[model samples]
Target: MKLPYLPQDYSKKEHIIILSILLLFAFTAFLLTIISTTGSTSDYVPLTNIYLGTADITHINVTKVVPQIGPILAILGTALTAPNRTLDNIFDSLKTISETPALVPLMYLLSNAQNVSQSLISLTQLAPLAISGNPATDTKDLVEISGLLKVSSNESQTLNGLKNLVVPMLQSTNTSNKEDRTTELTLDLLADSKDPLTVAKSLTVLNNLTMEEKMKMIPIFTLFGVTKNITSLIGSLETIVSKGDAISPARSELMLTTLQTMLASNPNVTMAFGTISSLASGDDEKAAIGAIQTMLEDSNNVNTTLSSLSTLIKSNVTQAESSKTSLVALSSIIQNVNDQSKAVTTIAQLASNTDTATTTAQLSALTEMLKATEKGTETINILSQLQTSLNPNSTTFKYIPSLFTLLDASADPPVSFSSLVTLTAWAQQNPQTFIPIMGILSDALAVKMVSEDQLTEMTPTLLEYLRIPVYFQLSIFTLCKRNLEKDILECSASHAVQNLDFRQIIYDALSASEFAPYLNALNIGPNDLYLEGDLLNREHEYVPSIKAVLAMNILGIVFAFVVMINIGFLFWMKWSSKSYAWVIVIFLSSCTALFLGLSCTVLTVVLQVIKSGTYKDAFGVVFTTGVAYSAMMWCSFSLMVISSVVLLWVGITERHLRIPYLMKKNPATIEDLENSSTEADNAIQETKHEATPGQIIRHSTDNSSDFLKNDPDEKQDAVPDIQQTNTSDSS
Candidate 1:
């Protein structure tokens, strides 16, 4: 039977195609209904609501029969698109679908298969069976399902589904609700599961929930004894740490963070403080350090937190002295603490205790603490005590190079200054031990001028310290020269000078009367200083010229003029006579202009490269091609190329057309010539009728003779032929 809109004359193929199109349109409409209804509950059309209700029922039935089809759908979706999928590809596909008018209706269908709320509800129901009392049989299934939940949580839709399924369960106080039962099963798995992998997976899933959801689960977790389970997990990690076995740092951090989240959310401060302090001296002291750092973040817990930390450190010096990781974590913790006096005193006590066996760890820990501590009277006092506490001849002095490295330009100005002053005193007192590090100190000073203005204050101290030894001055100058060469190649000339001003500062300082003995000893004078200034100033002159060259806008003006000329040429070609010659002229001019524009663009780029390479030395001049000029050249060349293509197309397609008015002939002259030819033909016809047939032949012969007489050689041949015809007639 034919459809109502289709004609009766339609063939079977036509009918099939029309029906298929109709089906696609209907499907797209249904997809729109689903998306429109799902996006808002209040705006749902009655028909759309019925449609969605039917879809959700079908979805629920399929999920029940398939058992965990949500995860199956997620895996299938990933597998189908995972081969070469990238963020770029996904964005491009979405962009194309949105931009195309034909595909806009189908855009909502892309995520239709991923609407897995019903499937998630089904999976939620199955959680108890997977988390049954039998670990051997259920652990694998529980881990797999939990992992699936974790992976699916990255999608907003799946995450919403999870929130809906799990949040209500955590909020529900009823013991008989299935969702509440599911929550209980999950918490039991966390508390009683022997496999660390199972516990870690469960914690990760919980961590992936929103903060509100976590807050809701905290009390439930506490009531289920999950907090103790987490603490025990931390203990296990600490055991693994003490045994020197490689444990996942992520797992350890997760355990501690989970415990912190639980306790911090709890209103009981005594329990939180007691729990934190208990873990502070455990084998996993890093966990306690993290917990304390979290507590310190809240201003209410700062005093209690610092008190606990101070107590732990004072009681466990041996532990703090041996663990480098714990030391670094502690240093980071106290870096931002408001009250540093307690932390400093406690850490200084650890630094003051030196033993042959633990000297290295203690020195490392003290250095980290000093680095983290703000530079002030407290730091100075700490350094003075360390100066006396550390043995002058101990092997711990091996870290002097590291200590000297703290003068780096990136370091805090106050810290670098303090370090420099302290090291200078040490050098003055013990030249033998600190002498070897003077070269390192000079190298760092020469590079320090490149930092921000705060570091410039160290210039006088650095210069005074280096002036004590002539070789130190030479080492600094040499380093400054090397750095000048490297920095000049990487920056503009002015920037390079500003960065390498340390050399100039040293030169100016040495030229003073206070350093006259040192300068005279080195045979340096005003001429040396003037020569250095001249070398630095010479590169500044090149900067203005380079800027002038780059600032030239002549290329854009030329391109504009060329575009205007091409526009006029286009009009002239169109309105004037059409011919092969005109076409050739247009094509050649366009092609020539195209190549010339292209050549200019390439030449400008080459000039930029040559200039950049030529001045990439002590001059430090970097040349860049003008982007606007380059764009203009390319655009002009592209327009010419298009013109040339069009000219060629016109020439080929209209090759058969006649070239009228080749040079200067007009329509009137052509009309006059046509009339004359017609009159001449009439004259020949009249001659043919009025005279004998021979007369007609004679007239034709006369006309042929006149045509041949236009050429010299043809005229001679025609005369002989006429004479021969006359002779034959006489015979």
Candidate 2:
């Protein structure tokens, strides 16, 4: 306790000394600042900033720093080179690990990690400067440089999101017989484990363990249980989540999964989900529930899991409503099949509660549960019962259109085009139920086009419904066809070309395929013959005017037939009686030339009319009328000309009374007639008694007799001389 210097002297000397030291410190500080101020600031922008009075200038804003600071840092770092021997040991161990063929990559990983670790130590060397000096950035840079060697997510973030060289392996939780010794060491440092070396040894034991050996570690985790290490695991979870690490989702998922599995086994991991759920609401709630639901859905303890879910649900009833609402499907999915009755009922209650949010997702989920009703009679019946409770329009059909959307996925069994078709089918099956959907479809059509696949998918359903009432088909045909255009345009870049086929298909389908049925049922035609002056009748005007142009051929034939009939009938009538027969003669003579002349004149007129230019309006009808009239005139003229010629010939022949005339055709010739006159000299007295003074004569008994009978024979010379005298006298 005795002091080498006396207390008072010691005090005075120390006080004076302390004052001198303080003064000296102030002086040197001033000198350094003055020197720095006098210097050029080509290298330091901050000095220029200080000169401008834009920033605070400082003493360490040195006019010059030792150019060798880089080597100085190296040399200073070497003074603690023995302390850094741990890094060497680490490097050598890493080298050994590297050269160890099997662990080489991991060794390189560790080597880089060692560099990062060394850099961290180097940053420690810069700590005083970082903490107490304006060069804090430099210190921070050193820290960052250490971290940049690539490792850890938090370290990554800290080190400008520094990566672990073997990041996937590094962040990965190893649970093998030969465990990740690095991870074990990290845990030892991180966890404050009771025996870090033992824990370290345990990590080595894990690494050497085969997959089978790794299996042995399960009980260890199982025994340690999730609850035992909940805090640490959650911390890691929180770290990953907070850092928003690139693999956060995956990492968090794994962490959560592990927590869930461990908790499910021990019935304790529910805490984490519970913790997460409490902070979340709405979409967040569903997510938390989803996390736990995945775990609980598979647990052997169905009751426990459901109870946990129910418990989780109760914590935030809104969340429970949400989770239950969401998990209803997932519940059905992963929940024990045996517990489905209970689960489904729970799901039904959640679904039925109108108080719950009707978000599209909620609506979708509720609809989906109804869709998934394939398993049990009880489940299906319950769903059916629940369906009855909601508004037919507001609750069920309100979302039937979404079912059509789900068709896009075209999942097998449930998600096929047929599934979408089924919705349409259901709409058709119960038209009243899905009428709104048609309207929705209409609106949808108005926005973007539908695809033909979608149309084809729904065609049967639409057709089936439309077939019931013809009015529906006719009215909806335009819609169906137009929407089909929309359908085709869905994929095409060119809207113009898109629906061309659709127009043809739909137009043809209704216009042609359904033409008869549609027209018949509606009692409509292009011209309404049956609509005779009904109230809706536009106007009624009836005038008997032949469509002469169209009917020209018909009219001509008809007139010709009439003329022929009149002629034939009159001829027959006249032949039956002489009084009528005279009528026939007069009729034929008067009408024949007139009809023929009229037809010829009409023909000429029509030919002239047809030769002119096209009809301005009525020329066609006028021309056709002219043609028909001309045809009638010509036909009459032709018949009359032939008839007149025949009658005149008959009269002339009838006036002649010679033998040839009796025959009227011929009696060989007139010479024969003259010879017959000589022969008649014998029979003339006997046969001269023909009626109307008609004469009959034989030409001769024989050819020679006719010549000789008129001439004198040699023995009849005397008779001939008398005959010659009589002949001369007669001449």
On TM-score, the leading prediction is: 1
> Candidates' lDDT values, in order?
0.32, 0.29
lDDT of 1 at 628: 34
The reply for model 1, stretches above 4 Å from the true place, is 1-574, 578-632, 641-660, 663-669, 672-731
After superposition of all CA atoms, the RMSD between model 2 and the true structure is 50.4
lDDT of 2 at 252: 37
Q: Pick the candidate with the highest lDDT.
A: 1
TM-score of each: 0.18, 0.16
Q: Give the CA lDDT, 0 to 100, for residue 515 in model 2.
A: 26
Can you write out model 2's per-residue Cα lDDT over 1-731, one digit (the tens) per residue? 11011111123343234324333332332233232222122223322221101000011101011111112122222321333333233223323322222232221211222222232232232222312323332223222223222222232122111112112222232223333333222222213323322322322222333443333323222211222232232232223222332322443344444555656666654565665555443553345445444444344553444443333223332222222232232222222233323322332233223222212222233223323332223322332332333223322322322222322222121212222222333333344433332322223223333332333333333333323111111100011211221121111121111111211222233434322333233233333222122211211110011112113323333333443443344333223123334345535444535533543454344334332311222111111222223333344445445545554443232211111112224323334534544654655445555524444343323432433343223111011122233344345
- As a TM-score, model 2 comes out at 0.16
Model 1 C-alpha lDDT versus the unseen true structure:
0.32
lDDT of 2: 0.29
Tens-digit lDDT string for candidate 1 (99-194):
333122121111122323332232223223322344443233222223333333132332233223322322333333332222232222222323
